[model samples]
Target chain A: MTLLHTIYLIAITAEAMSGAIMGMRRGMDLFGICMLGTVTALGGGTARDILLGHYPVGWIANPEYLSFTIGAAIVTAMIARHMHHLRQIFLLVDGLGLVAFTVIGCGVGLEMEAHPSIVVLAGVITGIFGGLLRDILCNQVPLVMQRELYATVALFTGVFYVGMLWLEVNSSLATLLALGSGFLFRVLAMTFGWKLPDFQGKEIRGLD
Target chain B: MTLLHTIYLIAITAEAMSGAIMGMRRGMDLFGICMLGTVTALGGGTARDILLGHYPVGWIANPEYLSFTIGAAIVTAMIARHMHHLRQIFLLVDGLGLVAFTVIGCGVGLEMEAHPSIVVLAGVITGIFGGLLRDILCNQVPLVMQRELYATVALFTGVFYVGMLWLEVNSSLATLLALGSGFLFRVLAMTFGWKLPDFQGKEIRGLD
Candidate 1:
């Protein structure tokens, strides 16, 4: 397979795994698990297409991706007994998905002749929007709001990739460099349990 | 104010109220409450614009809208006790937002010269996406997932609006008719607790 196709496959696998992990944490039923997996797999691309004004949506156009996600969900559920230790795997997989998506998003935005600021925004959206959608579906505060440098890391990586492009770096090399940076940053953060400072909530007493 | 501007104001107010409700339900503090209100207020238009490749994003460009939403959020929070019996009011306000946004979305999509199907999709995105965003931020399964017929109703209204335009109907009349139809459907569903059938989840029992 071509490099891009290979990357897509890896991304899809990571997404499905992330979905399974999210599902297990939520104690969702098999159907809910599949729903999460599909969202994780296709949500970012769908959002990207919508933003680019690409009609019908990528997932709707390619039903196979949905089927693959569903199949992975089933496999995850069946192995739930032995998958108790999959949380670490889920975090890694989510990181991989984030890196791959950010690269592809920036590339697509550039292809569409979008402004630099908008392209960076698109990369961030493509990297994190699916996770946001998955979290929403599973009824959890998204990782973005959970005091992590999740989105900030993605944002930096996106700008890094865009800067490389502007500096005349080869596209392939730029993508590889950007993905590696994002992945390393995330892995280090996960290992060290790093987090953003919490925003002190309001002092008002009767708000709730 | 012109009728369109008046309706837009009403939509913004409705969305802010919805956001406050979501925040309160989640026990969020003032910042979270205000953020939720803004999400509810501008989310649909933002989603539609992003999807349609409309740049600068409507609310982001018109900072006044964001300020208005924040102002509404504060007002709603201050009067939380008086709005305790807010279910009926919430439903009606939500309905109005849906209708006004639907008209605005369709009008913009048409102007952008998108395909009919794409136009309708954009309209629905404008109508219902804010609530979806609010539900996601509040860590819920979004009101639509309950099979509340929310998106379907928006789709019907969008299609009807587009069809009327195709038939050379007056823009004002078309907007009014579409809004009325969507609002009526939403109100009926809310009043009668109408719902669609849930999807049958796949069984995943055996093969790990």
Candidate 2:
């Protein structure tokens, strides 16, 4: 398999495990955990494909991906208590996954000949929407919308990758540069507790 | 426009108004309210089309629908304080919308030649997922998963509509029967306070 493909598989497995943990915390049954995990792993790509009119969405075309996500969820459900110590590792893997997913999404958008802006947006959507859907299923405000620089990382990665392509960089070179820079950016953001500005939502009123 | 088309216009407007009200109660700003309203009106069909790999989703194909929903939300924001008196009318129109959405969804499924079960599922998805998405964006567990017979009405409408088509009933007659019966079912369920049995979720544990 290609390097990107290998990373994609690993990223989806990590994403599924995190989703399973969230579902478990919410006291979901095994079925709910599996469903949530699958959605978390694949929902972004599904949403991107639908919005872009890409056919036979990723998981549907490759049902093997379902096996990976469902298996990861079930395994996580079985050994969740022991997972607390792995939190650091999980975060690192998750960040890597976010970067990988963004680059991969940009590739799809480029293949579709979308505008550069739309290509970047597709990348961001693919990177963050899975978590967004997972938070929705868990019945909470999406952290990406309210928390640290998570979505910003995706946006940066997409724009950088697209810019490299526009500059005639080799596709493989662009992918590696985007992934390496994006992952580093995410790591630094998390380590330093970086965050986007929070709007003073309280000042905005009257609709109610 | 056809009767079904007319009801659809009214339905989206009503759905958008309700979504705007919810956003207002959540203290969202004007932009947030408009977005929530549009998603509440159009999200179900968008979701259904994506799942079915149907291209050119309804709203994307007819941008005019956005004007209807956005317009309804803006108007509702300006006059929501006086809406309490119209609760009864709102509920009735909402019920009618639910049934109409279900039937129209089934029509699309039929056009795609999906299996009967999938067709019915598409109908249900198109009927309720808008509200499910609205609730998600507002950060709440979806009421359809917990409340009185709402999704069940969609399920019943879909099944009845599909069954009539199978029996070679005229399409227009089948549409009328399904819409009338589904609306009556919803109204009666509401009037009598009918509800599905809630599973005791507290006893479910261990995965966490």
TM-score of each: 0.60, 0.61
Q: Point out where model 2 deviates above 4 Å.
A: A1-54, A58-132, A141-208, B206-208
Q: Runs in model 1 with CA error above 4 Å?
A: A1-4, A24-27, A60-63, A202-208, B1-38, B47-132, B140-208
Q: Whole-model Cα lDDT per candidate?
A: 0.76, 0.88
| Per-prediction tally of clashes | 1, 0
Candidate 1 per-residue C-alpha lDDT over B7-126 given as tens digits, one digit per residue, 9 for 90 to 100: 888878878876775575556645556667888888899888887878657863465786788788878767765665666666677787787788788877987999999899888999
Tens digits of per-residue lDDT for model 1, A57-176 = 767877888777888888877886777586677678778778778777777778767777667767877887787788777667765644566776777889999999999999888888
Error of 1 at A55 (Å): 3.6
- Model 2 chain B lowest lDDT segment of ten: B199-208
Q: Which ten residues in a row have the lowest lDDT in candidate 1 chain B?
A: B24-33
Clashing pairs in 2: none
Give one digit per residue, the lDDT tens place, for model 2 in B113-201.
77786688679889999998998888776677555888889989999999999999999999999999999999999999987643234
Top model number, lDDT? 2
